[model samples]
Target: MTGLGWVGQVLTVEITGFAHGGLGVARHDGRVVFVRGALPDERVTARVVDDRKAAFCHAELVEVLTPSVHRIDPVCPAAAAGAGCCDLSFVTGSHGRELKSRALADQLRRIGGVDWEGVVEPIGSSDTDAPQVGWRTRVRLAVDADGRLGYHRHGSDEVIAQTDCAQPVAGLTDGLAGLGGLRPGTELVVSIDDAVGDAAPARQIVQIAAPSRGRGRQRRRPRTGPPRVIEGGPTTLRRVGERMWQVPVTGFWQAHRDAALVYSDVVTGWASTGAEVAVGWDLYGGVGVLAGALRDAGVAQVWTAEGDATATAVAVNSFADDSGVHPVTGSTETVVTGLPRPGVVVADPPRSGAGRAVVAAICAAGPDTVIHVGCDPAALARDLRLFAEHGYRVRDIRGFDAFPLTHHVEAIAVLNRDR
Candidate 1:
């Protein structure tokens, strides 16, 4: 195989299924090939992009010999041209969820070693009835050297030129056209509060020009002082679950417009089904959204731990004297042990998921219930296994099409201590 010059080589393969990262899997000469811009059960001619020794070779779709019936003309050029924004947008949102559910099951079985032979419940509420397009509430637009704004091409830092992105909130799409006055080569981070059922007056916009430092690798710099607000004040208001949350432009929040309410409802519903909570811990809580939800659900006290100073400050300001809400500024792994043990624990860690130390801390605390909200399936699966080792068993899990028209899916896995 090392002797074969695989780059630029064209091969006809029948796509059997999709892998976790939204790539179609096929076989060529007994070697697994991953092809982008192709769907399951479709035969296509793909050109080798990376033939280096890997778990599987990578290929790019050149021409579709047999297109799937579900394939349609992609609305976004980035996806159609294979710039890697939304390759699965060619299929309907419902079908995308089915594929995502299947991929999640595969990840759990292969990586987490858990054969969850059950249905992954689809999560949605009354607020989300419109189409999946223009669902993103927050977006970070990249700035190229030539003063163009768009997303980066797949696997490269070169920002692709684009006219308009159909994924962001409709207001954001309108706002981008007016941002031509900004300086060249400056990234802009923006958030829109145009959730479903909100009126035009309730809709708000907040944006900031990120400080660019020679674009090597994008790493989040710890906020030392107040964030330099360029557009709309220092903090922006995000309405979630009948309450408004003050979120800094740089702070973390759900990208999907309806994710906040859906997640809060799911978490609180799971908590309400079990024993009443004297106290609950919201690890990695951002702006106290879930903490507030837990408190509203009759929890006597909710202690939320967050690492970002700005976000924690916003959380504290948003619930300063609520008497039931306590916002602490620290990482969950280090701060979780400092708090008293509670009846319930809600952890929504980043894409990395909660590591072993945090899981150990939660397990050591002996909470009766644990709700893990994860964006990445592989990380969620690994953490689920760790939680199982610590005497907690998965009671129920639900997957949400929060990020519709995309491969990314959010899941909430509820675990209870096995007696």
Candidate 2:
């Protein structure tokens, strides 16, 4: 072992803490080491995979000589094998929430440059004793060259065949089993309509085609049977409260089952129904859920913009009864520029966050109250700084542990323009 290379060298190290991607971090010879499938305060034997001289290194867990008290047996085979789903499966619900809170705090302070001392309020997974199983309402399934349905392991293109996944809701996994006969190289996504009460009766599967070798465009089609085709309609309907929304089976929706209600409550509370809002905009709105909430709160006119054409069509249907709600189809940065100045603005951008151009435009419009919903803390931080530069200050910030047992978090920030 004296002069061995990094690949197969076994080294004993004590895990100090967890990193962003849920990997256990350790120190070896004054260098940082990241080990998959490890826990804090445990002594583990790790095999170095990538040795970056003196700066940091990546390693795979070979064996745990001493385990932490929080460690437990993983519920799913995929998570136990570290197959990309839940790397923090060993952590209990309460401890997992604690770790996520710390991660979010660090991101807000380090990336967003905001002094946030508040705790990450747990919304969906508040019960510390509740079992962390079957929380994921949406699951993406990948088909290998052999036409088998499974998921690609973390950081690798090779697919890992999985028979059972404990992360998705009860009925959703059963829906994935129905599409086992998909044609070779077919990619699929499964989502459960949990809004149908606890039973979650609707289980829909959609086939998503990857971009062609040289082309950058991809196509999505609902898959009922095996031989894949490029043409199909909406797979199922998702009910949020009294409204039913039509979405492609593979369309983007919250991964958490209770996310729809939870997010809506947070946004509404921050929006404050008491204030008289004549006109408001819900940017990056999907299926107009927030817009519908605003209209219910007595907003005279609510306009929503979504980048997806399919989601815009469904938004039109959801708000057909309410003439006050207007649906705009285009990217948020493009469409928001044309609309008249609104009393309030709500944006729930993707992980990349809203760029400077969009933020500048919103500032120019000068909305009295701006509601920013974000999934990435770093992106939120950067955008919050931009908002502050344009005479808007963060009035309130609340975080929800939407995605449990992982590093991901959903945050809400309410910004008020200075008069």
Q: Please, what is the TM-score per model?
A: 0.90, 0.87
The Cα local distance difference test for each model comes to 0.77, 0.77
> How many residue pairs clash (N, CA or C atoms closer than 3 angstroms) in each of the candidate models, in the order given?
0, 1
The residue-by-residue lDDT of candidate 1 on 226-259, one tens digit each, is: 4344565545568775677777666788887777
Worst lDDT run of 10 residues, candidate 1, spans 122-131
Instruction: Candidate 2: list runs displaced more than 4 Å.
Output: 1-10, 51-54, 121-126, 175-180, 195-200, 211-233
Off by over 4 Å in 1: 1-4, 117-131, 194-230
Tell me the lDDT of candidate 2. 0.77
RMSD versus native structure for model 2: 4.2
**Mind giving the per-residue lDDT tens digits that candidate 2 earns over 267-339?**
7777775979898899999889888767666678988999988889988987888899999999888898888
